[model samples]
Target chain A: MNHVIEIDGLTKDYGEGRGVFDVNLTVEPGEIFGLVGINGSGKTTTIRHLMGYLRPQKGTCSIEGRNCWKHAAELKKHIGHVPGEISFPDVRTGMDFFNLQARYLGIRDKTRVNSLIDRFNLDASAPLKRMSKGMKQKTAIVAGFMADAPILLLDEGTTGLDPLMQKVFTELVQEEKAQGRTMFMSSHMFDELEATCDRVAFLKEGRIIDVVDMSLLGGNEPVKEYKVEFTSDEDYQTFLAQSFLVKRHRDDYKQVSVLLSDRDLNALFASLSGLDVRYITQVPRTLEDQFKEKYQESEGTNHAY
Target chain B: MPINSALLRQTTRENVTLWGVLTAVQCLLVGVIGMTAPIAAAGIAYYNMLPGIFMGVYAITVGNKLISSQVDRGTLAYVLSNPVKRSTVIVTQVVFFAGSLLAMCTLSAVAHSLGAYFSTFGANSAEIQTIFKLNLGLFTLALSFAGIVFAASCLFNLSKYTIAVGGGIVCAFLLFPIMAMFGSKFAFLSNLTVVSLYKVGSIMASGTGWAWDLVILAAIGLVAFAAGGVAFVRRDLPL
Candidate 1:
């Protein structure tokens, strides 16, 4: 029940309703809480407040009961962060920056450092200015995680990383989670959040619309969806007459997408036994769909991804 | 101290090439040029004003880049991510500025002393002492100018605004004296700037009050430098 991080009525109004508005959330110790949202959705703003880089106008963000702004220098001792935009110091090479960070953080052991380099396939000897975006991202990842702080704040954590690197980054996050590091991550990738987070919050236009437990989307009582296409119009019409929730129906294609509990699957298949069915496939239910369902009507005009 | 060392090393390494070029140019202008001309006039004209102005310009460049531009470029975010306080970062920047000023001024003074030594064929210790004092005045004066720019760098986030305001004030300080040459009415405007205090002919004529000049320069430099640290601590960075 102890919250490692907590935000209470935090608000910063940047005029024209642009900034975060009355956001409240708590992150318990060892919880990998995810903030999933599209661009310009106040993810960075919220994280900035937690980092004590931005002051809140209305409320407070606290780490272990200490005010973030008042005790920023103290709080930073236990936190590691990766910003959305990465700009390194004016050092000559990646190695130079790494050395500088190590000195600044007072970290001496190079064992974890070398392992991160090997994992990311980073050539730290190259000049920082000459490094590519992916290399820079990898370098930032290593620097942020190298300190091994108990808390991590990552804003768009996997941005600019290639798919292969992203997979590596996700695996690294899982490893960090296993070690009980409390993390607050903002990412546009739903699958990443789905794979790693215990709970994910959906934000839109600087407001938190919902916070969902990922475990609820799985577990004992599961809701499964299946799309059934009938060979003719009569079978499609007959299937729709049965006691099944039709999520979507395309009359032209003679297809009916139905949502039902696992208990209803026997009745559904038995009813379809005599039907002229062309194809039946289970539709994957994902965090993306759950997010869309929450705010689809209100945000219909906004391009999500 | 670690923050100071890391930032200082990075800044010094980044600027070594430029510093080397400036030092060579100072050697040529202050060292080689003073060897041929009449010592007093050359001291007032080339040694006092030229190198002093160059030092001011260099201060402006370094002060602008050290903090404000770094914030604009997003590097300050990384610095702030560390456990170091924002006030400590400003202190580290101030240390870097002072170190750079010391390095640049020491090399220039040595170069000018070599010129004065050769101009007198290695005989007049008095003239070399005078050059040292002159360069000391120039270094302090440049520090005052750089201090103003440092405060501006801390106050503003954008480099263009910092440069415009900082560069504008320093340029006015340098140019007002030049404008005074065309008319007597404008001479009062030149007196208001720090560069006006470096009038070598009058300082040489007075012979002993360089202490007051040094005090004024140091006071202005220290006050501005202190103000920069305070401003950086209180102000919100765009990071």
Candidate 2:
């Protein structure tokens, strides 16, 4: 796969208190790559470096084989960037901004611009200051899409959007993916990412703790969650003691839910051959669960966010 | 050329509302001031009142806002993210602003020349030339102020700090000459300020002093622009 963005040992320090440390990551061409992390995880910093808004203090970040800082204008031609905050001059209407951006990007497609306006449901006549957060976000997104650049760098693109707009955005991203455009998105929302991104890199304190390929994780053997209803309390206790499955939750003496991997499930069935078995229901691991596990393992602590 | 025009169009479009209102207010103030004192009226007609007023306001208003607005509106990140070089952006902004100021100054000079010709005590050819020189000197002063402020704005990211430093620098330039007049020993101090250039222009329509002032202004403007470009190129923008 062609790598669209390649970052190696990128470091940025804002005084002594804040900034990103040596960071490395890559986004392949035509892939929707997600950067997932909590607030202050250096997600935005990395995006800034990739977009050439910030020069890396050390190492290199390149887009399409061009070092972003050194070849910013050339790299910018191939990339469309959306900042975390969408702000424009209060005096300019949406149409004015669109016209300026279109002219700058050398776009002459009025139909495409109008189509984007319709897709995002933005009011072209309204001044930028009057638009709602979601509308502003849509404007920025439309502007990015209008550039028709091969790469899209979005920093927390869906933070302020409502659920409906978020869904629309996800669909729009999917559409872009279909067109073979590469998207590198930094978002705190795991569910939104799970819906669209092909792969995700989990960043923790400026370092990528895990990079999960969604396809591989989703293709892993489906682990079935079974809550065996025992006839007697003693039988339940005996079965629980013998079972090697990871206990997820326990409600009562006779009621317990445990997560079982494929091998554990097979062993569980073989062991409970004679006992009355309860109905078995399959529960697949979500991206959130996988992420939580990785985060916990990496940090050696459970953080509830 | 088209790209440059497009960028110029963007800057013009963004500033139209504010600059339009400011220009109107300045014209009104000049008219009102012209009516107050007869001698001052001759000064206005002969010395080109509009350019002086416009330059003063433009230096304080648009000059201060040029870079501060980018940081205030959070569009700096988006603009800097583009493929364009940092130096290109700085140069474009400086040239656009300086060109605009020059145009206004030239127009005001023409208007003053006409106003003097039609006034009760009309200005002669020499007076018209002197007014022209004063306007030119003022334009350079304003342009230099813009450059200095632009540099300050770039050096400091915070809008409040940029404004403070920019305003303080301009104020110092304006006040140093007045303060130097009080003490004979301190008279030389005025030579260090941009106000000295304006004084020389007012005294001599065509002289080596004005030429030196223009050169110094251009050099300072170039240095300010270069510093801003370097800072922008080197500093990491907050994402």
List A-chain TM-scores for all predictions: 0.91, 0.89
Ten contiguous residues minimizing lDDT sum, candidate 2 chain B: B30-39
Residue-level lDDT tens digits of model 2 in A109-217: 7888798888777898887878888888888888777787889998888877889888888998898999999999999898888888889998887878888887755
lDDT of 1 at A119: 94
Report each candidate's C-alpha RMSD, comma-separated, in the order given: 3.4, 3.7
Q: Which residue ranges in model 2 land beyond 4 Å of their true spot?
A: A15-17, A218-235, A249-265, A301-305, B1-3, B17-54, B120-124, B185-188, B200-209
Worst 10 residues of 2 chain A by lDDT: A216-225
Please provide, for model 2 over B48-98, each residue's C-alpha lDDT reduced to its tens digit, 9 standing for 90 to 100.
Answer: 324444555566566656666677667765556555666666667777777
The C-alpha lDDT values of all candidates are 0.83, 0.72
Task: Mark the regions of model 1 whose C-alpha exceeds 4 Å error after superposition.
Answer: A218-239, A242-244, A251-284, A300-305, B1-3, B37-39, B121-126, B206-208
Candidate 1 Cα lDDT to native:
0.83
Docking class of 1: medium
lDDT of 2 at A14: 75
lDDT of 1 by residue, B123-224 (tens): 277766677677777778878888889888888889998899987888888888888878988878878788877767655563677768777887888898
